[model samples]
Target: MNPSIKKLSDIAQKTSKTIIGLMSGTSLDGLDIALCEISGIGPSTKVELKNFASVPYDSAFKNRLKAITSVPNVSLQEVTLMHTYLGNYHGELILKCLRKWAVAPSEIDCIASHGQTIFHAPKQQHNQPQMPNATLQIGDGDHIAHKTSILTISDFRQKHTAAGGEGAPMAGFIDEMLFTHDTEDRIVLNIGGIANFTYLPAKSKDRPSITTDTGPGNTLIDAAVRQLFSKEFDQDGKIAKHGSVNADALAAFKSDPYFRKPLPKTTGPEFFNLHWVENKLSKAGITNVSNDDFVATLTRLTAETIAESIKSILDDKSHPPLYVSGGGFHNPVLMDWLRKLLPDITISSFENLGFNPDAKEAVVFAVLANEMLAGEGFKMESAQTENISFGKISFPN
Candidate 1:
């Protein structure tokens, strides 16, 4: 065990810590800031989301990030500049949130930042022998710590990749900690820019719980809306409801090789972007579809992929109820489709479990920061479990 991990464990167990967990998903919508009071660890862990807010990214900032993300060969200098800029930008958002909540900066113990993922290339995606699975998240902890004057833990995914797992859906670690039940099997689904889930089997001995991306979430729908309707998002699925789904287009969308891949796999906008959709449509000779119909088909793509993934993992037995979180829950069309597809199982929001559905990811990072500060590490039976202390901590000067 590293001495630092031991020191953090002692600090986490002994002190009453206030942590701010920050998350900015691939959606580029806004920064989710969750102020939480966390105590204990593993099954005994307790979390209180005392304050929460989503600071929307300005159109200019959004465009800048979109330009950097959508293009293939961005300059390294631009990426470097954005990394530091995002750290300071996030720090500013934190201070603004603290002021709105009337909390003193000194009262906050630490900040756990998920950072902004610019690119995620799993070995499966790249298949390059020497490269290994690689991912990048900007927002430097040193800049955050220096600007916020608080201990900061950032760049959490690197540790997971270093441990030989894809640096994604880190949500599984926190989901198992907070939602695992002894008597029933449960699935905690998060539909962000991408869809992913954690399967907690009814038996505690079912070592190595399952977690992986379930194909597209809102990424495709949002992209279509922007391209066809000039809207930022589908806006409660209203546009989708107005449009009908084209069966031919829907079938083509579902035929992608990704949906057929085995579990423990992951993907992102890189694979399911507007170009991917257009290419499929072009191949199917259906380029003349209506904008609304396109949106509807995109929404169905998310629901169908998600339903298939769940079936692949759970099969006939239903132990764990499905609890969902993330921005996608707000989409009525997608939710309605899921409800119809998963009628046999109980489907509810994370709020029912005492956590805000939208703020759950942010809170998880806060808990991770607490674990890092306290020097606690996770041990999992799954191949995905690295059993290593995740996140690098930077001290404020």
Candidate 2:
């Protein structure tokens, strides 16, 4: 038998495997590395975060991604270079993290990397005929496996799109496994660069849980901050707290057809970026809005859209508590909007459930990798995500 295959066979038999999961979100902020020990398979799975870290990219690296991702067109060479560069960068980042965590590469069983999402244009967003629902995440799996010298699973979304999904809100498959409640219908709402949620019905048999991207989570706010104040993000949303939301601009922005689309929809900064915001402002005929006001309005827009999306899917008219995760929960202004808008709904951080919100997404990828290894043709299905085993594996040998 091949040495690599033998190693994999041995690793699979272990009771608990130490897996490293990496996530570089659309925010272009940094890479999230999560080391998780996951056991069991499917709904019987158990996951525990042993260590987690987010290594921020320096301005030069982030600028490179922005030039490649945020723009409509770019040099193909740079895009090609970025694909390889990001993979090697992330692999080295994982090695650095392993050193800091005082663990050897041999100690880890596998690596699950959610490569940087540069473009997420579903056919609905592009509106181009003959284009299937599409999305792109860079950072090659082969490079990661070679650099890390560990078995790696990457590019999990391709299978999702191929399986008739919008290739997003991939959370439901894992969220239901990790955080389902038997008596309480839980909404595991994640607000990363894009806001999405997993609706886990209390009784899994009666109504299957669904996951969907609500709309702009932190993407627009981050873009506006980068444009107005030359910052990657509005720290604690301080700028927005100082200003009032422009009702006219908010109304105009809400008029988008994307908001009217049905559930199981997906979107990204491509449709909800600074350019989109500026266009909305122009249509609203509001030219003199201050930076703070613009930021406030964007904040309001995210909260309103998220609230509305959640409300739209309540089959039992049951307003369940939201267990929130991701970067948006850190912004007090955004949190405040949710509180003020949905006064009766209980809003709490994922930390309340003993999971770091920042590390949740990374942990998810790790869980997915675990599923790939242990699934055993297990039936994994949700309303949005099809019953499919994702992630293309790369061997380091």
Candidate 3:
């Protein structure tokens, strides 16, 4: 047997494993690297986030990625090249983080890489009867493993699409495993480039879990701030705070059929982008919207859409706690709107539950890797989903 396979077997049999998770979301802000100490499996899983960092991308690199992201057409050459480029770059970044934390490559068991999402096209978005639901994430695991001399697992979304899911919002399994409560129902909201939430009913309630994307989170706001205001992000919602929401523009933003779709649906920056916003504004016959107001309304749209989705899932009398994670949680304007809209419910950060909100997604990928290696088949209640033992693995030889 290969030494790498033997080592993997040993690691899986161990009580705990040291793993690193990498997440590069549609926002294109940076790579989130999380070093987690994970133990047990399934509902008994325990994860300790030992160290984490978000390495910001330089403007040139961001532009290069933006060139191929979320569009119908692109240079195939660039996409192929970026797969290797991003994987090696991510491995280099992880090594830097490990060095800063006084860790070594050999000490880590595996790296779970949720590579950058280039395009996500569910059947709902494409409206093609002949084509199946599809999505694509670049960054090859082989490059990452070879670069860092560590085992790697990646390209996790394909299994979902193959299993009849939209290949998105893969948080339901983890949320149900980590956040379900016996007495209190919970909603774990992750507002990445595209916002999504997992509704975990209290174990006592005997309700099935539901997970779905709730449209744009920080994608549009970040885009408007960069293109219009010449900034990377709203940065504490200062731009949005200085402006007011345009009611007409907000209504136009919400007029999309995606919002009316049933639960368990998915979307991405591919669907909710600047061009989509401009078209909606034009359809509403509204113009001359200021930059600050543009961001403000977009921010409100994120909060409103998220709130509407959460409300739709809840029974009128039961208001479960909503714990938020991801970039949208840092936006005061968005959080304030959510509070005003869901006054009866409790809203808090994932920190309240002992997890870093920003590092949550990276940690989630790490947990998934742990599951792939050590877990006994765990499945969510919705859609007859398969077990959690997925992800293609690469051995460091």
Candidate 4:
């Protein structure tokens, strides 16, 4: 047997494994590195988030990435080069983080990397009968494995697309495993560049789970801020808190056909981008709105859309508390709007459940890698992501 295969076999039989999970969301803010010690499998699975960090991307690097991501056209050569460059860069970042934390590469069993998503084209978005549900996430697993000298599992979304999924919001597997409660139904909401959630029915209820995108989260707000306020994000939602929402602009934004789509659908910044927002503004004939008001309206749009999605999943009598994790959780104004919109539903941070909201996505990737190595298969209440194993594994020679 190859030495790498033998090592993998040994690691699989171990009582516990240490894996470093990496996530670079569409926000392009940074790479989230989560050092996780995971044990067991399925419902018996357990994880300890030993260390976590967000290594921010510099302006030049971010610009280069933005130039290639989610656009209609791009240089193929640039895309190819970036695919390799990002993997190596992420490997170096992991090594640096390990060194900073006084750990060696040999101590880590695997690196589960959610590579940068340049484009996500589900059949719904593309309207191509010929193409299956397609999506692409760059940053090569082979490069990561070779550079980090650790077993790497990357491009997990391909497996989902191959298995007849929309290739997104893979949060259901981990969310179900980690957050499901026996007595209380839970909604594990991740408000990233594109907001999504996993509806984990109470174990006692025997209801099927549902996971879907809830439209924009911080994508529009961040893009508008960068162009207008010249900031990366609305820190604590200060701009939105002061500004008033324009009802006309809000209605125009909500008029999108995507919002009318059925549940279990997926979308990305590719659809809910700056251009989309600008077109909505033009349709609303709101040219002279204050920047703060624009931000506030966008923020309100996010809150309302998310609230509507959450409400759509619940019955009149059942109001499952929403435990939110991701960038939007930090925005007080967004949180405030959600509370106001859904007065009956309880809303709080995932921290209430003993996990770092920022680290949750990365940590979930780590859990996925663990299941791929030692578990039977990905089992979830949602059939949309069940009975499948994700991630293409790369062995370090």
By TM-score, the better pick of 1 and 3 is 3
Candidate 1 structure quality by residue, lDDT tens digits, 168-233:
888888888888777777889999999999998756567568889999899999888888888899
Clashes of each: 9, 0, 0, 0
lDDT for 385 in candidate 2 is: 50
TM-score result, candidate 4: 0.97
TM-score of each: 0.94, 0.96, 0.97, 0.97
- Shift in Å, residue 26, candidate 1: 0.7
lDDT of 3 by residue, 25-132 (tens): 999989999999999998899999999999999999999999999999999999999999999999899899989999999899999999999999989889998998
Which residue pairs clash in candidate 4? none
Q: List the residue pairs that clash in candidate 2.
A: none
Global lDDT scores for all candidate models: 0.86, 0.87, 0.91, 0.92
**Cα lDDT for residue 25, candidate 4:** 98
Ranking by lDDT: 4, 3, 2, 1
Measured over all alpha carbons after superposition, the RMSD of each candidate to the real structure, in angstroms, is 2.6, 2.1, 1.4, 1.7
> Which residue segments of model 4 deviate by more than 4 Å?
379-386
The TM-score obtained by model 3 is: 0.97
The true-versus-predicted C-alpha distance at residue 326 of model 3, in Å, is 0.7
